[model samples]
Target: MKKICLIASLITVFALSSASVNAQYYFFDGDYYENPVLYEAGVSVNAMNSLTDLGGKKGIGEKFLKDLNLGYTSISGGIFFSVSYKNAVALRLEGTFGKVSSDDKILAGINDAAKNRFNRNLNFRSNISEVAALVEIHPMYIFVDWPAKETTPPRTSPYLLAGVGYFSFNPQTKIGNRTIDLQPLSTEGQGFAEYPNRPIYKLNQLNIPMGAGVKYELSPLVNLRAEVVYRKLFTDYLDDLSTTYIDPALFDKYLTPQKAANAKILYDRQIVKVAGINGKRGTEKNNDAYFTANLKISVIIGRERIRR
Candidate 1:
């Protein structure tokens, strides 16, 4: 009787191990796991913020997050399409459009480190449009969950993404009741023969997008994701403000009389122009950057399942 009981226990252990192995090889519900390729499409809404030379922390100016101001945050949205293999890797193509703005007027006070910026009195708003191709890697699938004997994909997955993108922007400022485009005014001597080094900055340029996010499998056919992505830009003129203030006369030489008039006021909005100080317009050391926090919903659009 003792030998028979031992044999029964050993058989039970072997059977359970075999069942776990088989579970990994099959999708209990259907052929979703057997699918060799999966396709998804989605849309996202985001809150956009700028890290430019204007509008920064309340006191001293700083770099990166220290200068972030939610007062200038704007709305943005986009759509994306993706293809994935075995839920481990994905390639996504996406396009987004949004607006970003900054104003120096918000920083006002005597004896503050930001007083210099407040006195400069510069401001701008821009429309940003971008398209990118990104690669996403799911480490959980590769390292932890792929071998699990689960009948479904993991409910949550963390991912990392990096991509290349092309974007366009046109910076604008308001003067009186009228709105003005800054590039043509050459407010800082851009494209001026007098300032040979200050070449025209193209409205369109390339950017690098990098960030991380987590995705939740809401259902077999749907997923939800929350992500934050920062765009690395090559140009410092996103707000049409970079480098020191040019001689006001340069504007009249390079632009029409009407534009020159607007440039003077738009360039120097200071209540009282302090004499003997060559004004600094914006910091040239750092290029502008923008980021977005997005909530996205995606639906599986197509799949190719392997035949049993």
Candidate 2:
């Protein structure tokens, strides 16, 4: 009877110890499944170019100042914040503001000529600002366990992102010492007798931004990322500088003798009656597109399970 009682007591102690060990291990292992959140910020650069023609005479403008070449490539830096869940999905919001301007030589000659014609240069310099939002998906670790190897520490998984963006831009050009005074292509004939002095351009535009990028974990609480994106805009007058010849009859009506003296301005401003200023000429189309590259570092703000 004594031996049996001793055996029963030993069995109960062994079972209790085993239960305690199991509970401790379960708590340690199950913590990561709770899901963690992350946040990030970064900067980007734009490699931009404009595809358009010198409305007047192509070679003439090329020899002097390239009208079609009036566009910009600039470094635009901005802050981007994201909220990530499960380490596999995130929502990112970003706002960027920068000045993009073309080289002055691009329209120097045209500006000089416009000054001579209208008593003030009709040529101008342009600038723009941008903003965007996106949804990201992490694929590498969606189903895989972290701290991948027993000897390795846990790290962030890789991901992909795609989304749309909206932008509001104010396009303005500088003419002489005064900016935004003369309308682009607004005047008719040798002088500014017929055209309006207000700036010529559609001031605002909505654009579509879409692209993809990758992210990698640098540490338990830090990450590195890079991405490339493209923006497709709705308007063609980003440069706000184009020219067409004045009609001979209209020239006679609008221009004084001094304004009509320069025939080149009239020739350049002349457009087919069917295709008015800013009108589509034949198969030609006007739309603008640009590419951007970005680099960012993210810091994990929420709970991250530490594996031992």
List the global CA lDDT of all models.
Answer: 0.80, 0.47
Model 1 weakest lDDT span, ten residues long: 15-24
For every model shown, what is its TM-score relative to the native structure?
A: 0.86, 0.54
Off by over 4 Å in 2: 1-34, 41-71, 103-125, 141-160, 181-202, 241-286, 305-308
Q: Which residue pairs in candidate 1 collide?
A: none
The per-residue C-alpha lDDT of model 2 at residue 64 equals 19
Error of 2 at 104 (Å): 9.6
lDDT of 1 by residue, 1-308 (tens): 34334533544454344334322244524655434345678999999999999878778778889999899999899999777656777777788999999988878764587887777778899999988877889997767554355646567989999987888999999878888999988888889887788899999888999999999988667889999999999999999988877788887777889999988878777766763224677788999999999999999754334468
TM-score of 1: 0.86
Quote the positional error of residue 11 for candidate 1 in Å: 50
Provide the lowest-lDDT 10-residue window in model 2.
Answer: 19-28
lDDT of 1: 0.80
- Write candidate 2's Cα lDDT for 209-236 as tens digits: 6667777667545677777666776654
Candidate 2: C-alpha lDDT = 0.47
